[model samples]
Target: MLKKNNSTPLYNQLVDVLIEHIKTNLDIDEKMLSEREICLKYDVSRTTVRAALNELEEMGYIFKRHGKGTFVSGLWKEMQNLSEAYSFTEQMKQLGKIPHSQVLSLEYIVANQDLAKNVGIQEGEHVYKMKRLRSADGMPMMYETTFIPAYLFPDLTISKLESMPLYELYPQVYNQDIKYADEEFYASVLQAKESEELGLPAGSACLRIRRTTYSQENKIIEYTLSVARGDQFVYKIRHSKK
Candidate 1:
């Protein structure tokens, strides 16, 4: 039973009680109690239970599948070093797992005005657009789309990408050295279309990352958008007092 004697608020106290139970006796493979059940057991309102659940979810202690209830997700702590600039293949390689990209769609496309502006290419310029579902140990990890300036690398093909990392192939195929890159990251709920491609529940939380790679001459050579599983990946930034 959760004690009502804490400096913290009731909902926070309830959240701690729930976490304690999970750490003590809850089997990781078993589904957690539903909000209604939790409320009834703890003598709290549904609103309070929802509040506690939201906090636990944000802390990555639990995850909910649409219509499937919540479950413990302790695996997130192991994948905390996701802020580094490593390709899916390279990251998994460091973790001693083979990485593979299942090519979803690849084609030569005329750069639309929106894509052209973002990638620093000419509008209507030819571009090689590719989409792939990245998997590690046969489990889907990310859905990514890439746009490369075809004028710079006309030989782009899905076959080549499937066998090699983009960073490794950039110098060889296009002779374009990657000097630096800029990336932005954010959290978002999966849209219907994204959920379909990534095999996640619609409205599921996910991480959206956009990155642009540059050459030594300061030319933007590649732009990529990636959606990763929220429960399986975390972006960490280490800081030291200056």
Candidate 2:
């Protein structure tokens, strides 16, 4: 129920209520209450309900399907804050969603001069190149390729990589403490292969995330390129006053 005499507009109040419900009770693709249902349940007019729903849609909290109804969007389904370094597996766990990664391939390759310099390694140094598809709650969200300096993880194996997120093994298994990470993201379209792996149509808009992980001594640990479906991800960057 809404406070009819409150200073805030009825529709605005309704929007806030629905946002709370979305965060606590809704899942991606779950159907939302119809305008009629909302009007009756919240004791608001149809106009007010409509306005609240519209606001939710505009904020990327919900999406509508013609001939059906509005549903929770993937935007609120999985969120990643770029303000801090992140681990996909740990983040999903924090959100109470199961996280999984499928390793598509792994191979040893000699690094080119540019690649070596970028990762703080010697030219022609061998590296482990890996491709993986990552998901949350069984929904494909990102397809990524990672490069790790072979010299750093000499005992690295495909089986070990499949067992857990690469970041988790840094300190526990490899005795390498993470110093920090640098990340950059940009808008792009999914390529054919990437689209297929991520379960999206070719040419679908995507956000490309490039990250480089560093060890305690500032040595590059790994470099990764991740492609996240634009529809399924909301990237946030926080700013602070200096």
Candidate 3:
């Protein structure tokens, strides 16, 4: 039941109600009530129901299929704040998800002009390239490619990354620490190869993030490009009034 007198808008109230219903009563992939049914039950207009549904979809609470109804999403869906510098594994662990990674490729290569510029390294320098598919609770989440100067991490190997988070190995194995990182984000449609890696359809919306990480001395440590599923991840930012 909706209270008309409450300060919250009707659509927002409905969104809250639906989220509660999904959390308590629905299972993953379970179809939710239709727009018409929701309207009749809540005594709201079609516009209001649509607004609520749209918000829910954006928040990863539900997903709609063509010619089909909306259904509950999996519990592994995660939200990330743009201001935080946590690694993917750390973030997932914070959200109570079991994080895992599959190392697709790992090899040493000479940095090209573009790669060197992004990583603050000289061109023709040797860099270790590592590609991985990250997952949470056995579900593919993001595909990432990371480049690290080989000189800084002489002993890094594919086996080490497959066993633990890369960040955790930094200080313990390499005697280097990541102090902070600069990230650039952009919207992209997944390519056929990327879609196959993520288990998503080609042309699915995704967030492409490029990150340059530095050590306490401001020396460039790593450069990484990652493609995250748009339907499963949300980036949040918080601003404070001065």
Candidate 4:
């Protein structure tokens, strides 16, 4: 039951309640309750029910079929546009999801030949290797390992990492701003350990992304390799007419 005196608006509260039901109780393309039925069941007015349903439709949780009715759509799969630079935390926030990160490991290591080549640094240079699991609304979404040159971020620490997103930290804590990034994506099956971290069965289909982030000075700042759950995301690219 929704609290009459609660701070949240009735429509927003209704949206939350309906989303839970859709995610847990309904299947894809399943018909949802009519606005009148929702109003009766939730003890809310038609205005409140309509407001909530409009928000759900705009968010891609459900779709209306005119005279037919509303039906469940995607299971809240995240949509990502590859044409723009994005941060995982920022993207989740835009989608009304709570973003979380688990620092599985953080240590300093010497860059190997391939790693050095990827980051454009000397093979023996020291780098901070960070392994993290990224989640949205307590659901595991991706497992990633990142390498940042130690000399550029010598003061990086676990406490600082836990405080905010790495992209935010770069400028706030280190006075370093990202200029741009180059990325490559590949289709692959999840490894046993990676699947364990993402809460998926081993050999599950996954998307692997390699990113090289650069500073304004055209120097490589970070290199990250990420394994993401295939069902949880949709990546899009917009091409322009040349």
Which candidate achieves the best lDDT against the true structure? 4
TM values, all candidates: 0.63, 0.65, 0.65, 0.65
Name the better of 1 and 2 by TM-score.
Answer: 2
Candidate 2 C-alpha lDDT tens digits along 1-242: 68899999999999899999988898989999988998889887899898988898767789888889989996743333442438888777767889899998999999999889768899999998989898999999898899999988997888999776788788889988999989899999989988888888999999999999999988999999899989977767644343
lDDT of 1 by residue, 33-62 (tens): 998999889988899899999998776678
Give the CA lDDT, 0 to 100, for residue 187 in model 4: 91
* RMSD of each candidate relative to the true structure: 16.0, 13.4, 13.9, 11.3
Worst 10 residues of 1 by lDDT: 75-84
What's model 3's lDDT at 237?
Answer: 65
Candidate 2 vs. true structure, TM-score: 0.65
- Which ranges in model 4 have alpha carbons more than 4 Å from their true place? 1-85
Clashing pairs for model 3 are: none
Model 2 Cα RMSD, 1 decimal: 13.4
lDDT of every predicted structure (CA atoms): 0.83, 0.86, 0.87, 0.87
The CA lDDT at 128 in model 1 is: 83
User: Relative to the unseen true structure, what is the C-alpha lDDT of residue 191 in candidate 4, on a scale of 0 to 100?
Assistant: 86
lDDT of 2: 0.86
lDDT of model 2 at position 40: 87
lDDT of 4 by residue, 162-206 (tens): 998999888888888999988899899998888788889999999
Q: List residue ranges in candidate 2 displaced over 4 A.
A: 1-85
Pairs with backbone N, CA or C atoms under 3 Å apart (clashes), candidate 4: none
